[model samples]
Structures are given as structure tokens and as C-alpha cells.
Target: MPTSILRIDASSRSCGSFSRDIGDVVERSLLAKHPGADITRRDLAQQQIEHIRNETIIGYYTPGEAMTDELKAVTLTSDEIIAEAKSADILLITTPMYNFSIPSALKAWIDQLVRIGRTFDYDGHSFTGLLPGKQAYVVIAYGAGGYSDDGPLAGADFAKPYLSFLLGFLGIQDVTFVPVEATTADPATVACEVEKARQNVRSSLDAG
Candidate 1:
């Protein structure tokens, strides 16, 4: 079946963002596999997201007219974000690791998408992720050396784990990570790693 892929690029940098570049390569492969697939792109650098505030939280719980204008602008984007996410069969998140974690703008987007009783719900006993039938692919780029889920840097680095947690929280169990590590390594090494990631994406596309 044809799929709709939502491509979100969270890199603040210019075209030099290796993560975005790898994501483009993977998207191209996906398009090749599913010729009728539709792609929607969102550049977080171009359209920045406002941080969630106390007013925003209050607005989220209050009535429409009761919310101040500023609070409405801050907290009322959940419907739009949720609608877009719900429409997509696949989500492609491309983000460079900034200070060992996701960009603030991306986090803001996440906060908006994760509305209580919407994306997930917490009963008296436990939390339940409401979003289902969604798959996610994360492309992560880092300037330092390799950092996997099991290493000295594992707990310290919040990029991969945070992405995994967020997607998993949304009930997206079919999630994959394509990490293009050591971008700050030697030029040759970086180039080789990029090629490897591109190849991995190609293989994934072919398999799918």
C-alpha cells in the first residue's frame, strides 16, 4: 500500500547538517520503493516552535475564551500537530545531536504533540499510549565518537534514548535508528560513515 511519510528536519544548521543529508538519502530510497508515496517536509529551522510555559499549560486545561491570546498561541497547536501525525503512516525524524540531546525546538514540538488524553493517557493506575499503527525512523548525527545504548556514554547521551522513549510512549513500537556517528572525526572517516548510513537506508528500503 502507498504510504505517507512525514519528514521532520530538526537541524538548526544550514545544508551542512549531515543528519538531514542522510535523511534525504533515506527518503529517496523510500520513494523508490513506494513510488506513490507522499512526503511532507517540515524544516524546524525555518519555522521555530515556541517553548511550553505555565500559561500554556493553564490554557490547555481551560476553556477557549478563558485562555489569553498569548497562551492560546502557545498551547493550542496540539490539534494541528496531532492531526498531521495521525495522518502519516511513517515518520522520519532527522536531527543532529546538540549537546548530547535533541534540539530545543524539536523538544517543543514533542511537547505539543504529546497532549494528555490525546497521544497518550494516564489512568489512575498507569499510562497508555493511544497512538498506534505508526512507524518511525530516526536519523541521528553526532560530532563526537560513537555512543550506543550500551557504553560509558550511554546514560549521558540523551539523543537516541530520548527519541526511542518518545516514540515508544506514542505506541510506535516499530521504530528504527540510523546513527551517523563521528561527524567530527577525520574528513575521510565522516565521509565513510555517511556512505555506510546511506547504504543501510538503501538496504532497509529494499527489504521493505
Candidate 2:
């Protein structure tokens, strides 16, 4: 069977976006491996998903058979997002760090996907993820350096850890994170960082 890839980009900038550029490299590498892969692209910047609402929360807890039309309508986006994730064999997320975290649009997308009894299940004691056997690749762009373990600003980076935990919570344990740091530095530094990120993407794909 052909591979299925869900590519979600969270950068607001259309042009000169390092995250998107790195995503392009990742996509190309995947295509090189799986020439007939089915790729689904979700550009959050252009088509932002609405944040979860009160009605949506209520819809999640309501039994399917007992859900009213209004409740069903409020949770339609969540349904679609979960469906997409369920069908994908690989989840590719390319996002730029915003204020030391992920962008609002990306967070909204995540909120829609992390639905109970849809992507995961809980019995008050333990939780189980419904979607397993999927791999994820996350590419993050940072404006300033020092987000890595040895970096000075490591503690300030919430994007990497949050995403790592989120993907694992969704049963995507086989995940690779590629960081593009120091994007707002000098042109030479920016170029070096971008190249390093590209190399990381290629190496990761090659290893897989």
C-alpha cells in the first residue's frame, strides 16, 4: 500500500519562512523514498482552525446517540481532524516557535485533534491512545539560539517538550524532532542554521 503523510505547517509567513523551507526538504525526502505517497497538506496560517469552544467540550462528553444536532455541528472540526490523523501513517509538523511556544493556530489544531474516545481513551485510572503504529516528524524554527539541552535558553523552550509529549500521548512514539535555531541572527548565521536543519532532515530520513 502507498504511504500516507499528513503535512501540517504552522508558519504565518508564506515567503522566507525557514520552517516551511525545512518542511519542503522533509517532504522531498519522503517523496524520494515513497514516490507514490499520498500527501495531505494543512496550512494552518492560511486556513486556521477555530479554538475549541464550550459547545465542543460538551459535545465530546455526550454520547454519540444522545448528541444533539448543535453538539454534533460544534464538534465537526474535531471529527475531521481526528479522521485525518487516524488515516495517516506519518504526521509531519513544521512550526516556528512563537513567544517560546508553538503558534496559536497550531495549538488550535492540536486542540481539535486531541479528542476523547476519538484519539484516546481514559478509564479514570489509565489512558490509552487509539492511534498507534504511526510515526511523526516535527520541525521547529527558533528566532534565538540556546534552546537545546546545552543551550542557555533551554528552559525557556516549551515548544519542543510540549510537542514531544503531545505526540507520544497520541501514540506516536516513533518521532524525530529537527530544530532550526537562530533564525533572526545574521544572514550568514541564518544560512548556516537552515543548512544544518536541512542536513538533519535528510539524515533522519536516510536513517529510516
Candidate 3:
């Protein structure tokens, strides 16, 4: 059981967001296993998180001690986001597939958290991730395809592979994907998929 949890929701729709609802379930399940675990939530749908800009990139390279006020201001949010994840034993993230990939807000968060020297490092020849021993679960709400590895149009589904790669880059090897597919499909299909996602969440906790 984890002592701390980081929950992030990146769905655009707040009212009819199926991903957010499932994400809440994921959080609750984690909490049940680790009762009273400290949870830090970042709802990108309700907040305005700016995408990575050139100033941010420049600031990331600057040392903290030597960083100018301008650089610090630009990178503060990213630094805080990274710190939150670094403090968590587990991360629960849910993102609705936007045009076959993750939402822009989520991607921006990744850009900030996946820092070069902070979260990872390149030693001349090889790059090594610094954050380790942390687990992550990502809930994918897709309109079509991207659910199964052998499913049709697998190439079209970019969320899973991209997320897997990025999280792995950050030294998070234990990652779970609980996908609720076909949200734009019929109600029965949506319900079935939602149930599958919930079962997957339960199985993850049970296995843990």
C-alpha cells in the first residue's frame, strides 16, 4: 500500500467526462488499499496549465541557484508538479484521447515533469532516469480503437504507447492502463467498457 498518491485528470469535459468519473474510482480504489493515504490532485480540465515554451526550456537548463527571477517564475509550476509526483508512491492519471493522443494539457505536464537533469540525466553517452520505484495507472478514454494491442487501427492509437514510453523514461516501470474505449459508441458499449475499466482497477488493487 502506498503512503501518498498523486491523482491527475486531463479530460476536457468536466460535466460529461467519463474519464474523470473512472479516475475517481481509481483514486478511491487506491485509497481503500492504503487508507488515509495523502492524495494530491491536479485537475487539468479545470485549471489552466500552459504548454511548454521556449522560456521554460531555457529555464530548465539554468541552475536553480543561478536562475534569474524570470526563469524561476516560468518554471515554478513545472517544478511544483514534478515535486508532487516525486513525493507520491503511486500516480493515478486519466486522460481522454484527443485526436488519437493525450490531451494537450497532459502533454504539457509531462514536458515539465520530465526534466533533463532533474528527473533524468544524460551522461555523455547514455541517459538515465532518476525517479524510480514509483507506480502509475493511466485511464484512457478513447473514441475508437487503441484499446487492445491486437485491435484494429492500433497504429492510430497513440495514447498508450506514448504514455508508456514517457513514464518508462521517467523510471516508472510498473504502469497500468485501464482503458474505457468507445465512449462515442452506443450506451451499452460504453457501459460495458466502463465496467471493464472498473474491474481492471479492482484487479490491480487485489494484485497489489
lDDT digits (tens) for residues 1-208 of candidate 1 = 5799998899998678999898988888778877899888778899886777787677667776676778767666766787778889999999989998999989988988887767888888987887888988899998876587475666667898888988988889888899888898999999898888888887777677
Cα-based RMSD of the predictions, in order?
2.3, 0.9, 1.6
Q: After superposition, how far is residue 41 of candidate 3 from its true place, in Å?
A: 0.6
Which tens-of-lDDT digit does each residue in 66-174 have in candidate 3?
Answer: 9999999999988999899889999999999898889998988888898988899999998788789999989888887446867786778888999998888889999
Error of 2 at 28 (Å): 0.4
Which scores higher on TM-score, 1 or 2? Answer: 2
lDDT of each: 0.84, 0.93, 0.87
Top candidate on TM-score is: 2
User: Which residue pairs in candidate 3 collide?
Assistant: none
Candidate 3 similarity to native, TM-score: 0.94
Query: Which window of 10 residues has the lowest lDDT sum in candidate 2?
Result: 199-208
Clashes of 1: 0
User: What ranking emerges by lDDT with the best candidate at the front?
Assistant: 2, 3, 1
Give the per-residue lDDT digits (tens) of candidate 2, residues 1-208.
Answer: 8999999999999899989999899989988988999999899989989999999999999999999999999999999999999999999999999999999999999999998899999999988888899988899999998898679999999999999988888888999999999999999999999889988987899667
Q: Kindly indicate the candidate among 1 and 3 with the higher lDDT.
A: 3
Clashes of 2: 0
Tell how far residue 93 is off in model 2, in angstroms: 0.3
